[model samples]
Target: MSIRLGNSCVNCQKYEDHFCQLHETTVGTKHTCDSFDMRAAIKDDNNCTTCSRYMSATCPNPKKAAPHMLCNHWAPQEVA
Candidate 1:
């Protein structure tokens, strides 16, 4: 799927695990696709709304501004 950052998150770059600098997820290879960095984490049944990592005001991902509304990129996925 083509994951385009909408106006909500257009102000930032695509989320990269390395951007956090304080935290990183283990990616298997360098040649992997863009979606490779998205890791599956346990999500609340209510989607990103009740998700701590998502609604967090302090998340390092540039797209933290993205809302909890239903979107193609809102699903929980492991970063490995």
Candidate 2:
């Protein structure tokens, strides 16, 4: 699977306060690398409970989420 820095990095475990713990440096939201791992997305001061892609604070497509950011692949969560 291909990963984009902007969408993927925001939810990565290494990302902290705009810095990457693994890389030991600050990175932009659009930055990417091979060490990306999907963590729960941030809330961005909004409610994701209504979003279709929101899965208990996780996004399945990108395998990530962010409080203030949404990926291009965002979809409405289906109602069962």
lDDT of 1 by residue, 4-77 (tens): 32322112233344342223433323323333333343234544554345655544453644554444335343
What are the per-residue Cα lDDT tens digits for candidate 2 across 1-80? 97443445666878877889998988876787899887664433343444666765356544456545566555445311
lDDT of each candidate versus the true structure: 0.38, 0.61
The prediction achieving the highest TM-score against the true structure is: 2
| Cα error, candidate 1, residue 69 (Å) | 5.7
- Lowest lDDT block of 10, candidate 2: 41-50
Q: After superposition on all CA atoms, what RMSD does each candidate show versus the true structure?
A: 13.0, 11.5
| TM-score of each candidate structure, all chains considered together | 0.19, 0.42
Worst ten-residue run, lDDT, model 1? 5-14
Off by over 4 Å in 1: 1-27, 31-46, 49-52, 58-77
What clash pairs does model 1 have? Answer: 39-77, 39-78, 39-79, 40-77, 40-78
Per-residue lDDT of 35 in model 2: 90
